[model samples]
Target: MSGNIASLRKEFFQLKKDLLSSILSVGISLILFPFLLGMENSLKGPIFSYIEAFIMYAIFSLPYLILIGVPVHIVSRVATKNMKTYKWVTSFFLHVIPALLIGYFLFKNTLFFLGSTVVISVIFFSVGYLLNSIGASKRQKLIIALLPFILWLLILIPTILTETTNKALMNEPNPEVEVLVNETSFKPRPSFCWNSDGSAGCFEDKEPFLLPIDPIGEEIQTNGDVTVKVLLHNTERSYTIEAYYFDEENSIQKVTGDPHSFTLPQHIQEQAVKVIATMDSSKKGSFFIPIRTGNR
Candidate 1:
């Protein structure tokens, strides 16, 4: 009886360790995959931007990882522990099933979804294999798991310091503009419109009423005269749009327009604009539009 109890306790501990390792694998995959994607596309942004992207991915991914990944990992590890033939292959396929499912639902594009599934499955198998090879040494496994986060911090610290020093030297305050409008007057789409006869009525509110300024291209060139126009659909409520950019001396400058258009400075290398749409003195939403100049 004592032996059986001891065996059960050992199994429980092993399962606990496997669960922890599975979580670490999910974290590492989320952290590293965005960086990999950014590199593949030659994307440039601040360290915190990448971190924010990772956080958004994690929000959508954690549910699937906890619901599907943990159970699958624990079951497959236990099932294949004593198998003599094709154990790793079976484990790889098991992981691939969940990865493919996740990729399909997460991505809408067919080609991109297929490519992402392949990459994600390979990452899953490789991480799983590495963790298995580390045996039951918790300390060693943890260090390997946390290596990506440590590397990210190393990059982030220097970026924060450099930005702080430059801001201090430039003595420039971040440019911003605030305008207030009545929120009660703003008409969002009704939950269900009813006619005089108490019948449901159809309202033509298909598109978004308020939208931020859309740049002509992915990257805007700063060489010649540049003008950005704010597009707002609802003419019923009034909206104020302002454009902000950094000057040659790295000081933020604000440019206000006549309700629709704003002219930007021509000498800046890059323009980072924050478009804030507020109603009733309450902030509704804001978007960051990063425009980079020059040929890559």
Candidate 2:
């Protein structure tokens, strides 16, 4: 009786160690999966904006032990517990297939509703059913084996229906237009022409314009716009042109430019900066002549 008790204690410790190891392995794998994969385009919007993307990425990106990784881990965890070879194999496979399917759904953007809660529950049920139904008749084992899948389907069907119904009603919006300002010249020249006379007088009676400080930095502002103008060489027609201010966060802040004049906030005035906006690929060579308060 003493010998049997000691052996049972040893087996119990081994099983406990294995379980812990398997769980840890799965966790680490899931954590590393996203960083390893390039999935920027997989999410509907910015990855940061989408909750589904966050959860789905987590579900799929995990290490091998977490999903398919867990099954083999289970075998290792229970190896010393007198677990039969058939039972070990069955246990590993039953948990593994569902995990793989779940991971696949994440990768394929199909896991719209099957959340982490459902996934964890399925894994628990599979492990319990596999262990409990072992040594039972083949028919009983088969039924037990099917339980997780059936539960997954049941959980998934309603989730999918709700997601579909919700989307149909209040559909997600298109991605925010990523407006990029690709100005041909960062420090653009004034549109005014110089007078031929040596009096340094302006010709063509043009409004005075000011050169903007680099929106990116606090480089000292240039007082006067340059007179030298580059020739237009692009074949494309009209491009949507706008001015933007690069805030401290490095995001574009659009600036309103009206006929030779730019009205900026007090902060922008103090910084002496403006952004020249460019439309998408369609617009090629757009230019703006901005004005300073004194230059008018």
Winner by lDDT: 1
lDDT of 1 at 119: 52
Look at candidate 2 and tell me the lDDT of residue 273. Answer: 36
**Distance from true location, Cα of 220 in model 2, Å:** 56
143-168, model 2: which lDDT tens digit per residue?
A: 65665556556655765676575554
Per-candidate Cα lDDT values, in order, are 0.53, 0.42
Candidate 2 local accuracy as lDDT?
0.42
- Determine the backbone clash count of candidate 1: 0
State TM-scores per candidate: 0.41, 0.27
Off by over 4 Å in 2: 1-115, 131-133, 166-296
Clashing pairs in 1: none
How close to the true structure is residue 61 of candidate 1, measured as C-alpha lDDT?
63
